[model samples]
Target: MKPEIFIQENIITIGQLLKKIGLIQTGGGAKFYLEKNKVLINNKKPEGRNSKVKNGDLLTINSNIYIVKKEQDI
Candidate 1:
């Protein structure tokens, strides 16, 4: 159930990204999901909500995982 949307950045805030992309049902949903230890970075377990996601990294939530390729040019 991985998502196709990619996050591009040298260090992306998980909470901000989640809200920006409408992944969680709500803003609080992101914190709740993260506190439940349901989020992983680069296939490794992540516990910090403010964790930064860099390029070529991987992120997983629930059954969905996303790989951070090149940063999206804004």
Candidate 2:
């Protein structure tokens, strides 16, 4: 099953999401990682670290899948 990540806010940044899921050690790493790897949000490439990620959005990074959901949905 794909891992689920709960968002307390209506939206979260791609960088923040990466840290929350332990993909990157720090927010600063998101930029380098995004540039070096394949990260898809809803099947499309993200603009950058600031790209918005909302509830129910699907994220595929380096062949791994993660689902974003509201905290209350759990």
Candidate 3:
């Protein structure tokens, strides 16, 4: 199943993504979680908390998948 993520901007950071997924509550928590767990962005581990994710990007956290999509202005 493909999960959609709608955003108003061109991209979102890794830390923001974690929060959006409800994985972490705070920005500092995101940092700590990323350091402890393995998060794959488009099949590769993220370089840092600020890694940019854009449309069509694939994010896998703990084996679950999330797909980034453009927000439809309907």
Per-model TM-score, in order, reads 0.67, 0.88, 0.84
The collision pairs in model 1 are 8-71
lDDT of 1 by residue, 1-74 (tens): 44554665567777766776786666567777687756788777665656777776677777777876665687
What is the alpha-carbon lDDT for the whole of candidate 2? 0.92
**lDDT tens digits, residue span 1-74, model 2:** 78988889999999998898788999999999999999999999999999999999998898888898989854
Off by over 4 Å in 1: 1-4, 25-29, 72-74
Tell how far residue 20 is off in model 3, in angstroms: 2.2
Residues 1-74 of candidate 3 have per-residue lDDT tens digits of 87777666678898987887688998778778888987888999888899888989987877678888868676
Clashing pairs in 2: none
In candidate 3, position 2 carries an lDDT of 79
Give stretches of model 3 more than 4 Å off: none
Q: How many residue pairs clash in each candidate?
A: 1, 0, 0
What TM-score should be assigned to candidate 1?
Answer: 0.67
lDDT by candidate, in order shown: 0.70, 0.92, 0.83
lDDT of 2 at 13: 99
RMSD of each: 3.1, 1.8, 1.4
User: Which segments of model 2 are wrong by more than 4 Å?
Assistant: none
